[model samples]
Target: MTTLSQSGGRRLIDLVPHIVLIVGVLIFAFPIYVTLIGSTWDSATIGRGNLPLTPGGEALVNYGQAWSESHGARASYTPVRVMLLNSLVMALTIALGKIAISIISAYAVAFFRFPFRMAFFWMIFITLMLPVEVRIIPTYKVVADLGLIDSYAGLTIPLIASATATLLFRQFFLTIPDELVEAAKIDGAGALRFFVDVVLPLSKTNIAALFVILFIYGWNQYLWPLLITNSADMETIVIGITKMIGTGEAANDWNLIMATTVLAMLPPIAVVVLMQRWFVKGLVDSEK
Candidate 1:
């Protein structure tokens, strides 16, 4: 009887974890499933409430109307394609910019001997504590002074300096052996050549990982974009979706909004899926 009770107790413990994980997954997935299904229906069907679990036949039409907002005069916001393009540009530019700047900054701090180097690094690190919310006013003023508002530069440039990625790269660089530095020196590889050949290749996994993360960060930016962009053309997908719902409007186009949401989720999902291996390795694998 003791043996039977012990076995049952262990099984319950094991079963509990699995049950918890399954419940968590379902909680996250259910809303996504409902959104996908709702995207296929017409606005009236969704407006009526009690949305059906099954997908409707208006998938193509709904997607088309969402994608091409020029279909009619009733478009409440910028077209999804235009917003998508803006978001893609912002995400890619921010990701690349952050990675480039962070990697170079890390490489310099890790490899070079400069006065006040650690101080500079610490300053950058400290900025992480001063999030965008704290500095948005000054940032906006800077961008406004530079006349970058409503431009791609305004959308991405201010958001690109990433202290977290810089820290990660610095930590990874520190893990690299002194042997590689000597080896590169012996090969008569100048700083530029050594950095191009050695450091860049070794940091690929980290770069890929940060790129995916930074891309999503840029893609989801709302407050900065909202503050900077006054024109419809500069609207991002995140903001565009919000604009579509409007202020207490009873005639909200739920179908197009759902469709837009699904569309908005695709790029981040694709980035994660495509570079999944590198991302995982960058996070977990401990090779210099």
Candidate 2:
């Protein structure tokens, strides 16, 4: 009886984690579920202050209006298609640029001996203590002087070289076996060739995982994009969606606004969900 009771107690302890996880999931998902249901309803229904817990019939209409139609009388109205394209360009550029620069920087720091190497690494690492918000004024001034404001270069370049990504790559590269480097050298591989052939292939999981993270970060950027891009053509979907909501309470189009919000979330969610396996593997392997 004591043995049976102990087994039952162990099972109960295991079950406790699952119960907590289920509750957490429900709490996190409830807002998204409400947003999804609210997106399908009419502005009138939403404006009337009805809580939308069920799907409504205006899904197609709301989506169509949000995507293709313009918000008439709004001076800064941008097409959803244009905003989506801008966001895609910004996100892709930031992700690929950050990964490319970070990997090369990390490879140099990890493998090569040079003066001020640690200094450079520490300099990059120190940036983590200072977020974009803290450096926004200087960053904006540089972009303005470079004639990049309201341009893709302005939106992406200022944010691309990530200290965190550099640190992550450096940590991962240090874990790679020294024997691999010796083998490549004996086989007559130069520095560039060794890196291209040996290191990059081994770093795919890390690259993909970081890409997912950086892409989402770029996509969700609000303050930087808002401050940089004054042109409607360069506005990102995240900013454009907020602009959709009118000033006065009575003037807001909740249905169209919520539809735009849904569109804004899909790309990042899709990237994370699709690359979840690689992301998990990268995190695990990077630690080793």
Which candidate leads in lDDT? 1
lDDT of candidate 2 over 1-288, digit per residue (tens): 999999999999999999999999999999888889998998778778886698999999888877887773223357778899999999999999999999999999999999999999999999999967899999999999999999999999989999999999898889888888899999999999989998898899999899999999999999999999988889999888777764566667777777888888889989999999998998776443
Q: Model 2 residue 104 lDDT?
A: 95
* lDDT tens digits, residue span 1-288, model 1: 999999999999999999999999999999999999999998778878878999999999989988987432234767899999999999999999999999999999999999999999999999989867999999999999999999999999999888999999999999889999999999999989989999999989889888888999999998998999999898999999888877335757788888999999999999999999999998888766
Report how far residue 271 has shifted in candidate 2, in Å.
0.7
TM-score, each model? 0.95, 0.94
- Estimate every model's Cα lDDT from 0 to 1: 0.90, 0.88
**What TM-score does prediction 1 earn?**
0.95
Give the CA lDDT, 0 to 100, for residue 108 in model 1.
96
Which stretches of model 2 miss by more than 4 angstroms? 72-76, 286-288
Residue pair clashes in candidate 2? none
